[model samples]
Structures are given as structure tokens and as C-alpha cells.
Target: MFVFWLVQLISKAIYLYTVLLVIYALLSWFPGGYQSSFGRFLAKICEPYLGLFDHLNLSFGPVNFNIAFAIIVLQLASQALVLILNRIAFMF
Candidate 1:
């Protein structure tokens, strides 16, 4: 039961972070999006994670893939974690 709860919580967190990353990326579209308080708040949480993949030059011409890639990786990790947690839960 506890394991199920933990898995659900973690999965939600991962999904939320992915959404935040998308919002943060979209902020770049506005004239002063990143300069806003909300943008700053998002930067506090999203920048470091995005930084991990920044060097990959995920941009192609005008389209940037950094956020997309980060989200993909995060989702994959989340799925992997849930699988591991479910397996461990089954053992008990």
C-alpha cells in the first residue's frame, strides 16, 4: 500500500515537472515572459535540470529540442522508476 502511494506521488511529481518544463520553454515566446515573477519561479526549478542537457546543442536552426528532450528523458525515467517500484512492491 505504501509502495503504491509512493509510486503515485513520485509519478505525479515527475509529470508536474515535465509540465513546468514545457511552460518554461513556452515562456521564451513572450516579450517579457521570463522577466515575470512566475517565469523567475519556474527558472529556479527548471534551469538546473535543463542545464544538464544544454551542452548537447539540441537546437536545430530555429526549433529547440532541449525542453522536448528533457521531457522525454524525464518521462522515460519516471516510467522506469514506477516499474522498479511496482516490482519491489510485489516482493513484499
Candidate 2:
């Protein structure tokens, strides 16, 4: 049981870390400007995540905020919530 909980926590941590990384990449696009090929590559790789917003016909300053910050924030919150719920479940 403890091992299962540990695995769950680790997975949630990984998920939240990924969410933050995506947020950092998307946020990097606007301020000052993106000068690296890596940034462009990330943008391309992450394009599908942003595509959902495009389907909704929303835009944020030439970029899709719906998929950028919003998605990151939501995913982060979800991961956190799941972790909390798991803890509560274990406690009980």
C-alpha cells in the first residue's frame, strides 16, 4: 500500500513538473522574445496542446492563451488536487 502511494505521489509530481515546464515555455514566447531554436521546437511540439484553443477561436496577443497559460494552470491544479485527494483517501 505504501509503495502504491509512493508511486502515485511520484507520478503526480512528474505531471505537475511537466505542467510547469509547458507554462514556462509558453510564457517565454512573449516577453522580450524567443531567440532559440529550442523555443521554436517546443512551440511546434506543444502546438497540439494549443490547438484546442484554436478550435474555440480564441487568441491571446497573437498566441493562444487558452492552451498556453490556461492549460498549464488547469493541469497543475488538477495534479495538485489529485495528490491531495489521494492523501485524504490514504488517511482514511
lDDT of 1 by residue, 1-91 (tens): 9999999999999989988999999999999999999999999999999999999998899999988999999999999999999999999
Q: Model 2: clashing residue pairs?
A: none
Best by TM-score: 1
Please give, for residues 61-90, the per-residue lDDT of candidate 2 as tens digits.
Answer: 866456555566657766677677677677
Candidate number of the best lDDT: 1
Per-candidate TM-scores read 0.97, 0.42
**Could you tell me the lDDT of residue 67 within candidate 2?**
53
Candidate 2 backbone overlaps, count: 0
Q: What is the lDDT of residue 27 in candidate 2?
A: 56
lDDT of predicted model 1: 0.94
Cα error of candidate 1 at position 77, Å: 0.2
